[model samples]
Target: MAGVESAVPGASAGPELAVDGASNPDIDLLYDINGLTKSTPDWLDRAIGFVGEYGLLIALVVLVLWCWASVRRRPEPEVSVAGLVWAPLAAGIAVLINIPIRGFVERPRPFVDHSGLELLVDGKSDFSFVSDHATLAMALGVGLFVANRKFGLIGIALALVEGFCRVFMGVHYPTDVVGGFALGTATTLLLAPLAMALLTPVVTAVSRSRAGFLVRARRVPLPHPAVDLPEPRVADDATDTGSGRNDLAA
Candidate 1:
């Protein structure tokens, strides 16, 4: 019996070894599910890649230009100057707050740590708790919205597209994008009012200083009333005839 036991393949290794060597069927199933691979379409991959790379920058530049043009077209010089100064300042604050918050979170990038996930673009990031792209997009959206509700809605839509592209590109996890968006929105909601308040004086001063330039460059001046006149005088003959008829009828 002793010889037979000793001859068994793993008998000498003990029960601990047996347990340690045992394969976990549950884990195997999970691994299979996790590893269930699907190929990304070439066009989708390319489109996602292009948007992920340059979309935000293009959107931001266009927004800036649009805001500038909108303000420039405004009849009120003060409003135009305010838009220019406030828009850039709000954008800057959003970026500053977003960067530090992302750095602190330091979450692992999806492709870096998640097994069986394919990365379309190689992103050298150890910190991926919150996506910078999403953050910036949200910030831009909120900032633009603050400046002008109509334009802000447009900005938000563009930002959402950019954030979704990050996920579709397999560069960031959905959670990362969500977190970034939340952080950005919170930052904007909190800081935008404060920034506007602080910038109000500065913007006012700038607009006043530049009023002369606007006056010089002005192609047109607002039209004013040429004259103020008294109520019109009806013909005395018509008034007397109407009065005479009423008197005769009475």
Candidate 2:
């Protein structure tokens, strides 16, 4: 097919210009989604970019901390906090796992392969087969879910929005985000049992010692039950007999 013009105002080339071939659904979808940014105000576009890139991730971190505080107050804080701690660990590990995937796939950024894309934030020189943001967000979200259901749901929702923003920003393909989601979920879920097993003991020990405040709030001791005892019987009869004998002798 012939090349089409880029909708972006400053785009010098179109998708077809870079790769001269029939358009596939991936590029087509990329163009369609990114095209929405053309008519948006520059400030709104910037806001979206910021939220997608950094703001949401920060929010997720805060949510994780909040969850930790809540779980620590539980009767068995160590168990739940262990799961919460695994979330960041899982996210870090997932990103490391993606390093090889990105190197192996060697998929260039959408803006690089296909021109006419409105690049939101620059300095993304690495391969783009799997989105690091998506992977990290989903991993944290899933880890939160493993620790606490309500917070986990919120985390998952934030992750979905993060995926959409990556595509909208023209930084990644939809499949890249999907791959990230899959990798994150699998890593967190698959290895969760082992991670929990190792972390729980450490958390438990911390909660029992002087540093227990980190795992749980100071617990108030229960009040002891009051005990009842019988009163001793009086010796009125013996006293009365003794008094009568003294009166008769007098």
Candidate 3:
């Protein structure tokens, strides 16, 4: 009966064994990768940590500030105001979408649950489906780029660096960073137009108020000095005296 059961066309130990063995290479590779990562010098880890922490933050801040400044300098108040509104709105959307999605996916962070990675800094994150840092960096970069091309380029560069840093730091898998990039890019593109539309009315109102203030300021007569300054008196004799002296010398 055991031989008959084993001899069934569909029943086989071969497939089972193959399936079990399938994980071996992956496990071995994982171990090898982790071993290599573990051998990384301390300096590399420190550099990765620095870039992950300060580099991303500085890039984001600078991009936002640059956008705000550029918009503020515009002749129309709406453009500047709209830029301000959209930049922050885009960032907010990235956060709102990325956080919950990451939590729900619950993919283990690289070093925390996976054996093949080393983390530069330990994160409390429970999932590695998407990287929040990458999402935020990319979203901010795209938003800034939309606001101003030059600054946006800088933002994009920073975003790429940040995404790479996640992998280098060993807190996130490459797939996690890729997912984050996609989500962040999509979030920025989706929210940008909406943010602009939503901010239009507010920007218009602000522009109107600003125009009114300018009008009022122009209308406000400058207080004249208590007494008008007399015109400067020319010394009529000076030129004549100089000419006479020149003539005499001649």
Candidate 4:
């Protein structure tokens, strides 16, 4: 209860909740989880923290591979490339949206509000309404999925892991992660279609150029037209008989 801190005015954050009397059940649950997590082994701490820190990179690799594979399998280079490109593009939009959401919610980080909370990673003074990490993770995931369901599912899993580690490491409340998940998912889903629609022409053009050699869609949008060959001709038997009679008269 003592040494509790809230976010600065004008921008709200998750202030310190009572150990037993948090205004929101989600915050209360965070306290219990963070408290228990403090006793985890050093290796586990690092493992989860590593996942939280670099999960995006891992997800990005998966996205690239999946996109390449999609192109290879279907040869629809434009569509697969769009899926790959839209992932980070959609994530960028989600990050932009997160800026205002943080100011609006003004939730403080869990470690800032609670005493004896240990940090596995450096802490930021930013408001914790929704986590940027979680949002981007999910945004990338959803965008990738929109491009290819298999890749999208993997991306979503990575996003969930990022959220879990953020809480487990005492950097965020569960609600922060949830808000990020929702924001990321919604932003990507909305933007993916628009991105695909707008970028398709560019992608199609690129596919025809020398650079198009690199933009393998793996699947062709329209198959080439079929060709018709000429039929063969043979001499008739009656013509051959007439030729023999002329030869005899000669």
Candidate 5:
């Protein structure tokens, strides 16, 4: 339960906690990555801890809202809105799905089994397999991507960083983060088409209602270019004068 402040250096850190005392890549990777925390300054470690635990997730939520605000201007507001709506829903569903898996796997926190790890945050009493943070982040990322490609890519990148943060924080093994990414991606991608099919019509209906402002804003009219008018022509006064003279001479 201790944090990076209590990290043990070198072999004195203790023995491998793998089952039957056998070493595996998962734990090895966990230690290798978590080990980096010890090399970093405590302030830096704390910063990473805050970012991994909360900052990135908050950014993702803002990204979703940002995406929603942007999609309203798109030609297909209904489609975009439907996708944006699904992003959070997917994250929620993914986290809910992880609950049963966590209970079934009952994997303990990395700090519980391993020693000398630089745990960034403390009081992690729940199971560690398929981290909820990673799951929620990736689900939102993938779901956002389904709605808007540009923003979605940013979301996915953040989610990947989030996965690394979990391992770096010493709360989860690399595989655990991978499992979360897999769960989130699969759930969002697999059910996306169906979700879109159902949600689009509802969005379209909203687009037509007084609440349409939520879907799309009024279009701004473009200004027209200026043009010069031609001048009117006038008959010569000489012709009229000559005609009068000829009549007087006659």
Candidate 6:
């Protein structure tokens, strides 16, 4: 009887909970693009992946060197000092903002979501929204540009390249990189003037100290005196005397 009752097909089951797993459409598009990049030569793939993962460190070092060169008595010392002071400052601001957002957003990585995909570099399963690379790179680029056009242009290029690489390597979404760049650029520009003002005294004092010998003028305001010094005392009387002598000789 118990078997017969069990066989009566457990009274019709209630409707099951339908879990809506809809994902952002951007993910598919970005994933498609990343896949396309893999068709390239293996050498290229490896090279690009390396750049995407590690090239920015080189870029950051280059930026620091640029600032250092400028600060160390190079042309446009004021601007150089600005670059030196602001690049790290902006990067720090970017990192600060990124950390909180990363935690709050908590997005999944592509590799984790889609297994079987080849990875050229080490990847993380943590959130990928708003890439830290893009944020910091953009901040550094903008800060450098503010200080010097040439350095700024280079920085911007480097940031753009790094963003593309982050997307190409499949570690980050296109939106993640784009959002990071936008966020970083905005934060740095907005915070730059205030940060610089607040840090000036401290930086200046440090630069002036013996330890800052590497910095030109120790951050001191130097004379950029106008090139137009009153035309060297015209020696009007000497010329007049020469004219009279010529007349007498004639």
Taking all chains together, each candidate's TM-score versus the true structure is 0.64, 0.79, 0.66, 0.74, 0.83, 0.70
Model 4 lDDT tens row, 1-250: 1223443345432443223355768767777766665567778877777777785557666666766665645645577777777778888899998898777667677666565565677747777778888888888888778777877787788788788878877788888889889998898787767889987778778888877655663344787788777777777899989999999999
Model 3 stretches with alpha carbons more than 4 Å out? 1-41, 210-250
lDDT of 5 by residue, 89-110 (tens): 8899999999999877777777
Error of 3 at 69 (Å): 1.6
TM-score of 6: 0.70
**lDDT, residue 199, candidate 3:** 73
Instruction: Between candidates 2 and 4, name the one with more favorable TM-score.
Output: 2
Q: Where is the poorest 10-residue window by lDDT in model 4?
A: 1-10
Give per-candidate clash totals.
0, 0, 2, 18, 0, 1
Candidate 2 regions with alpha-carbon error over 4 angstroms: 1-23, 220-250
Per-candidate Cα lDDT values, in order, are 0.60, 0.85, 0.65, 0.73, 0.86, 0.70
- Better-scoring candidate (lDDT), 2 or 3: 2
On the 0 to 100 scale, the lDDT of residue 16 in model 6 is: 13
> Model 6 over residues 100-183: C-alpha lDDT tens digits?
787776666555554334556763656777798888888888887777778788888999999888877777767888888998
Give per-residue CA lDDT, model 2, range 1-250, as digits (tens). 1122343354333222224344667777777888888888888888999999999999999999999988878877787899998999999999999998887777777766566778787788777878999999999999999999999999999999999899988888887889899999999999999999999999989988999898898878999887777788776998989999999999
On residues 128-153, what C-alpha lDDT tens digit does candidate 3 reach at each position? 66777888788888877776777778
Clashing pairs in 1: none
Write down the lDDT that model 1 would get: 0.60
Q: Which of candidates 2 and 3 is the stronger one according to TM-score?
A: 2
Model 1, 1-250: lDDT tens digits are 0001111232222111012211854223323322322444556666667777686758775985686556555566454445445555655666677677656655555444334443546644556657777877777777777766777788888888877677655556666677768877877778766676776566667545756443123458779878879888777998999999999999
The 10-residue segment of model 5 with minimum total lDDT is: 7-16
